[model samples]
Target: MELKRTNVPFLLSLALVVLLALLPVTKTWAVGIALLLGAAVSNTVPSAAPSGLGKMRKLALNTAVVLFGFGLNIGQVISVGGQGFWQTAVSLGVIISLGYFLLRFFRLDGDTMKLITFGTSICGGSAIAAVSSVMKARDEEIGVAMGVVFLLNTVALFAFPLLAGAVSLSPEQYGIWCALSIHDTSSVVGAAAFLGDTSLSTATIMKLTRTLWITPIVFVLSLRQGEKGKLSVPLFIVLFLLASAAASVLPFPVLFKSLASAGKVFMAAALYMVGFGLHRSVVKKAGAGGMLFGGILWSVSIVVGYVLASLS
Candidate 1:
């Protein structure tokens, strides 16, 4: 029997993972694969929980977040410390605020704008995931936000390195730029390594600063929900923070490396899920103008990131 379109995405995830595993993209990009699988499983898995694979999706996302620390050493994150922390806070405010303004200008209504603003301003996919859980955003809003970030992420992946090379930026400067501007950790690494190891280290430090804001950002959003009415510190947010701490304390050479590697696989899967979740019928209802408006938000935000980086 032919599989449904939903099942097709899962198959594609499996095929891509198998094929790409032979290429050089495996270690970190594996997270993208895990994202794909997660998205696919969420849509396609049957209700027969015993026979289904949906549980893996959650495991993959959690593992991906924890293992992500391996890509960034705790020592490096701490070394940058105060300055890195401040820069992250400032940049985050700038990006998210810019997103809210531009989205409002687009005249986009309701929750879609909020999620998009949060996603662009915070840490890309992770921001969307976290905010969605806390705000109880509808799936349509999540899809729109993901679609916007994915497009911009592809652009940042290519653009940041070329810009850095053209300007002849130092490893430190380029690293800080990548860490602050790029959408996610994987993209940051690609942009950083485009420069060198020193750039990678510095970029990861910058990115770590951004990750730390995830907690505060979520807390702020939870409050905006007027938590006094019914909101509180989300369990998932706490879970995310706890996962980070555990990763920092875990000891061992080989096992840690493997867990870290598993984490990458999960991230890959999550990203793939983002792409596969696209539901054209629903987004199309928002109209072409809606898409254009989202694009404008991203375009303006990129300019904001570059201008701020130049100033720094």
Candidate 2:
């Protein structure tokens, strides 16, 4: 009985993961549910919630990223990269620069700023996870960053598809717009899939191209950390690349797809754990500045992306 009592949080978290897997919702919904559940449980049953979930969060995040590689088609990513390299580069640069200026105006902590910026400039949750591990960010900071991204992602998932018609965007144009504007690959894919197969394929390739930037940016961030004697590249990043490469070469489509799906499940579960860290104090620390920064940056990204896509 005592053992079960001690394990309620873990068991509840596991049940949430299973529930997420059974639901036919978008990644955004799954994460939101898990986060809300964790927050509620923490407030009501604080004793059941553990003081630390860092190890599990990090492990789950890394494993999910590596497995996500299985869903990539290296040829598609390469072709998209070759063609849209400059576009992505310019967009990322613009967003990062904008983020730096926004930081001056906002009252967020440095780590939170970096997390939000990287997440916005690149691939939302995955970018936050990768950079957070490198910086050894606080659990509260990670939760806050992800929460901001989550809110925006939920808005995008619903809004983009609706706006596609308003903007008179063709499937190709909408796909490119979604790739550039949406923060997460899952959300981008979800939004594009609503348009049709052409949009889905284009968005996936373009989003994957953006994901490729994760390696270089993370490497640069690691070097800048100046941990003089401990300058080792993260193993998960390497494995993520290798997994993509193997997927490109291997003929086991069924297996790879299954792994990728499992990765999504794990990511949802990890996000639920991330929520456990979000108490009132953490949310307060995140401040209105963090939310504003995300909202403004995402708005700019949407407008710019729309213009670029229309031109293309």
lDDT of 2 by residue, 1-312 (tens): 234476587666668665775577654356556656766666666676554566776687678767877877767656765766777787899888898887777777888888998898899988999889889999988988987886677678678877878888889889989999999765676577567657866776677667778878888888888744234455875686688788889999999988877776776666566556556665565567778888989988998788878888
Which digits, one per residue and each the tens of the lDDT, describe model 1 over residues 205-248? 56756776777777777788877433334343345445445556
Q: Which stretches of candidate 1 lie over 4 Å from their true place?
A: 1-65, 71-73, 132-139, 161-164, 189-201, 229-275, 278-287, 307-312
| Each model's lDDT | 0.60, 0.75
| Residue 252, model 1, lDDT | 62
State the TM-score for model 2: 0.67
Q: Which stretches of candidate 2 lie over 4 Å from their true place?
A: 1-7, 23-32, 102-119, 123-179, 182-234, 309-312
Top TM-score: which candidate number? 2
* lDDT top scorer: 2
CA lDDT of 92 in candidate 1? Answer: 73
